[model samples]
Target: MIDQILEEIRRYETIIIHRHVRPDPDALGSQGGLASLIRDNFPGKRVYIVGEETEDLRFLVRMDEIADSAYAGALVIVCDTANQERVSDSRYSCGARIIKIDHHPLVDSYGEPQWVETSASSTSEMITSIYRNHPELVLTGQAARLLFAGIVGDTGRFQFSNVTEETFLSAAELMKKPFDRQKFFDTLYQRKLAVVRLNGYVLQHFTLTDEGVGFIKLPLDLIHSFHLQSSDASTLVNCFSTTEGLKAWVLFSEEEGLIRARIRSKGPEINQLAARYHGGGHPLASGATVYSWDEADGLIADLKVLCSRT
Candidate 1:
């Protein structure tokens, strides 16, 4: 699969890379890291990484504004995204050929020569493996930083169950590069004062069920009251994760008239539940959407039952 993907990369002149929406570090890391790899190895090729930029993560990499014409005869590669619906840009289909590079369980298979490694820690790790296998490919300091950030973000700073020997080996390899690791960690975790305050509020108000299921429902007004955006509120999902008897948790934050569900678990598989609610991701960590407060309650109820069974 790596050989096939490398061959495709060699064939294209213009390449556009994409990832899932609501950009997280892993999504941005893989998309940008792959773009960096291509740009460094194939200097003559034009590479553009496209996606909606998140304010907090913009320090890692910025999106490129290319015209529709740029997608003409381009090779589009989507990173870290499981399904087409979650892909940030609709323009992904405009490419002449498409490839998928992801670490999530296959949800929707859309790309040709798709590479899905569910056991891999992150798409960034998979991207790093590409450089490891192909000696001709160069790993720049910037690429190393991006890939490392992605691995850290998805693995919960290497605290999650996903980390394997390959994950550590990949990290060891990336650390050899000359990027400022301290600055990357500082900048990646620097949160606003308002967001800190909101975390306190979540710790106070989040609901914990007897079934070992915990949840937080942050409506739009409640988020604005904290002087933070919905994205800021979403980060607080893990704030109360250490609570005793907590088997699984979900943070439902209202955004643009819909509730975005960021689901995490300690014991139960939750991605199938996410899939039923217009989302999907790793079993332990996933995302979903709910249209109304009642529907959100339904999701919570479902999660509670799931935890009860576990």
Candidate 2:
């Protein structure tokens, strides 16, 4: 797979990298890392990283805006995205050849050459694997650092169950490059007082059902009170994890006319439940969006039942 991907890179003179919408660290990292890798090794190739930025991840890398004509003969490399609808740019389809590199479960196979490694901790890890196998492709310090950030971010600092021995090996390889690991952590975790207070509110108002399903529902007013976007508050679902006597937890924040949910579980396949609510992701970490509070409650009820069964 690495050989084939490398061959595709050699064939294209112009390369455009993309990831999922509302880019996460893994998404941005893999996109940026691959772009850097390609540029470092193949200096003649024109590389561009295109994506919609997230406030939390803007510090990592800058996104590029290219003319639509640039994609006419370009090679598009998409990372960390499961489905085409979630792709950040619609121009990806304009490329002469499309390469889909992802760690998500196969949702839709949009690219001619698709590499999906669901067992990999993150898409960044998979990219690191490619670098490991193909030493001919120069891996710069900046690219390694970006890949390291992606691996750490997706694995929850190696706390998530997805972290395998290969994850650590890949991380160790990236760490070989001289970068400030402490500084990266500091930037990744830096939060404002408002976010701290918001977390306190979430913990204080969190609900626990009889079936051990912990949940917090943040209404539009509460979200506005914190001066936070729904996606910002949804990230607080991590606070519900590691608590005693809780099988699964979800954070629901009002987004526009819908309620966006971020779901986490100590154990159990909750992505199936999220699928019913118009969203799906990894087994333990998944998301959903519902039209009404009643629908959110119904989804919560289903989760409670799932917990009881487990």
| Count of residue pairs whose backbone atoms collide, per candidate | 0, 0
What TM-score would each prediction reach against the true structure?
0.98, 0.98
**Model 2 Cα displacement at 82 (Å)?**
0.6
TM value for model 2: 0.98
In terms of lDDT, the poorest run of 10 residues in model 2 is 234-243
In candidate 2, clashing pairs total 0
Q: Which regions of candidate 1 are displaced past 4 Å?
A: none
**CA lDDT, every model vs. true structure:** 0.93, 0.90
RMSD of 1: 1.0
What lDDT score goes with residue 49 in model 1? 96
lDDT, candidate 1, at 66: 96
Name every residue pair that clashes in candidate 1: none
